[model samples]
Target chain A: MQDLGIRVLLEGNNMIRLLDGLWVTVRISLLAVVISIVMGILLGMVMTLKNPVTKALTRIYLEFIRIMPQLVLLFLIYFGAAKAFNIHISGELSAVIVFTLWGTAEMGDLVRGALISIPKHQYDSSAALGLTGIQIYRYIIIPQTLRRLIPLAINLVTRMIKTTSLIVLIGVVEVLKVGQQIIEASRYTAPSAALWIYGTVFFLYFIVCFPISKLSGKLEKRWQN
Target chain B: MSKTDYLLEIKNLEKSFEGGTKVLKDFSFSVQTGEVVVILGPSGCGKSTLLRCINGLEPIQAGTILLDGQSITDGKTKWSQIRQKIGMVFQSYDLFPHMTVFENILLGPLKVQGRTREEAGIAGEKLLERVGLLEKKDAYPRQLSGGQKQRVAIVRALMMEPEIMLFDEVTAALDPEMVREVLDVILELARGGMTMLIVTHEMQFARAIADRILFLDEGQIVESAAPEDFFGHPETERAQRFLNIFQFEK
Candidate 1:
């Protein structure tokens, strides 16, 4: 109690609860990221096609996700849709759905940019070598695109992790929610715990995000050089 | 037994950009086996575009192309398979930057033709040696000079043992000193009896290497003649004017 309310976390199972809360955040984000990456790559390739119908459709999807705020999307899917359709979804499920949709668009656009970023000569030379369209993509285009893509994609993962913090507003008991609960529950006993609690929460997020950012930076420098 | 005497032939070829500007218009030409044909043209005169169409790099607005006396549009002929026989080198020396010279040279033979490493490697190294690039096989494209990279690109094209090689201003992008190094390789190839279609601005080199000279203007062959005649006595006014520009430069 005297030591900046550090005793609150030191007390029975409060630290464990915070860790469990963090796991929820990690679970949702990682699941969404995985799905996003797989679908996003195909979507990206499709976006590069010269077909007009495909162009129009992908543009609308990308624009919709780009224009709408994630918080609003979450409410639309979780609360609005549920009430209108007489359906129910777990808060975690709704969070994952919204994030996956958002993340996929971001990742797809990155992939499309990467594919287009390849020099026109690369395709010409490969085609001149008698590589089929599929073979050209597999042998030359994808490898180069992957080299250009990995660092950016890793950065996207970090964004997803940080963004998962917003899910708590939808009643998901993620780390921030746990921290808030801890602050409210110990208000009388630990009047000063808010500072320490919020500080620890911020520290937790920094630890998770900083290494990912650093890893992406390191890869970018190494690969580009 | 042969359906056509020419190794490569194009009839009524037409190419335009977005149906707007015509790069090539009704071009009809042929390259015989063991022949070296040099195309000389002003900028935007369809010289490079002509090479690109021969290699099937451009979609024809209307035309027929015959390779090795066979119609390319026979439906039985796969374009990918057809391209394997028609090797092409670009002005930029479009080598894969991520690959070493050996990797770049051998990719066509190994991946496209499905040749064994032993078979392709021996041929690849021999061509590298011929181009005076044997020692640079392990070097990446970024590590090589402009001349060295162009030589590697030639080696890459030769690895497939193409029947006819299309050189689209291959030396145009090189420095003055490096240009000779690349032209020397083509000269040696011609001397060795490799049939070649070359688009080049190097007048002296064109005179030295070409069996026939095609003087192009506005997407048509203004004059086609033996190199000696084309250089010494250009037939058409266009050819004379084109050659005069080079003489004035000297």
Candidate 2:
């Protein structure tokens, strides 16, 4: 336990590496979230269109993303697609692409559910009030949809942040990868280094995610009232 | 092109839901400016559908609707433009639940008509004051009673300064005690000389406020007459039977 103290974490610039890896994880997750939200909202609105072709196409895309595992998607994009297309893609870029694809579908479904849950009379009333389609969405529909969406979307964001830890398998050198390196290096000197290293990474993830989960809970309660 | 007499005209309007359930069939009616026309019908009898067709909420398969002699049923007609002059109140009192009463009243005028918030607010306050709900300006719809919500819905429509208003069983969902407040608001609007087409089930209220009553059955206007004649001597057996049902319920 003494060897598992602060000294182990501070050894040979190990702390710096873990911090850098944590930064990478946060950056990737945040970037993916922003992209997913913007694209997801638009796609979700498209999903609500009455056109059968549009609905069918979006359904296919959403189902494909939902059914496939994110890790497999990561490997397909990073290794398989790169080799097949003969294009070079970085590990971090691949992680972003994979997570954005996953997050967009999740967020889009969330948005679609929120938008459709609005009562039919609300649309009829807005139309009767001389509002154009755009005005109706902007002034009435979207605001209500967003209020229903924020808490759920925040939950999705936290999920994305935690899921980003999986990127280490693709060689992104995120926090888990950094922890693995620290554990590998101290394996000879400290037999219990793996426990401490993995524990630290677990705590780091909890430190970031706990607040967001709490926030999502608060928002859900407030909106429910 | 000539000066039109009627504020609204419906000629041979036809509407049907999918799976071949006809809601309105060859329905024709008209309302003179400042006239109150009440539609009386049984449930599923297309009274609500006719009002929906007038406001462009339901597309008609055939026939034309003219607001002030201008065709509003055509594809070329801009619905938003036509809707600007036609206000509607629903049975459900569909006030935007997320918005304050002030915001609900001000939204149509400010967003669609491009009125400043201050200008809209002034008009909104006047309408609210007229309804004696000026204190509820900041109150959300969920905080209001059924009567208050319906009143707010009426004021929200009036905020657009529409030439004509349509009420589709506006009091059907209100509590027994709350119904009078909403009816009173409509009565006040009628007294103010606003042209209105109302679909309602309240027999006494209809007899009180309606200039003429149109009895609809099976998607057709079976009888159109002055309120006194319609109530005193209904033309058709269906109309008599319909009124009898209401009388029995009362």
Name the best candidate (by lDDT): 2
lDDT of 1 by residue, A42-142 (tens): 99999999999999999999999999999999999999989999999989999999999999999999999999999999989889989889988888888
DockQ of 1: 0.56
Compared with the real two-chain complex, what DockQ does model 2 have? 0.64
Q: Total clashing residue pairs per candidate? A: 0, 0
Tens-place lDDT per residue, model 2, B105-179, is 998888889999888888899999999999989988999999999999999999999999999999999899999
Model 1 chain A poorest 10 in a row by lDDT? A216-225
Write out the backbone clash pairs for model 1: none
Write down the worst ten-residue block by lDDT for model 2 chain A: A1-10
Per-residue lDDT, model 2, residue A6, is 50
Q: For this target, which candidate reaches the highest DockQ against the unseen true structure?
A: 2
TM-score of chain B of 1: 0.96
Candidate 2 collision pairs: none
**Best by the TM-score measure:** 1
DockQ of each: 0.56, 0.64
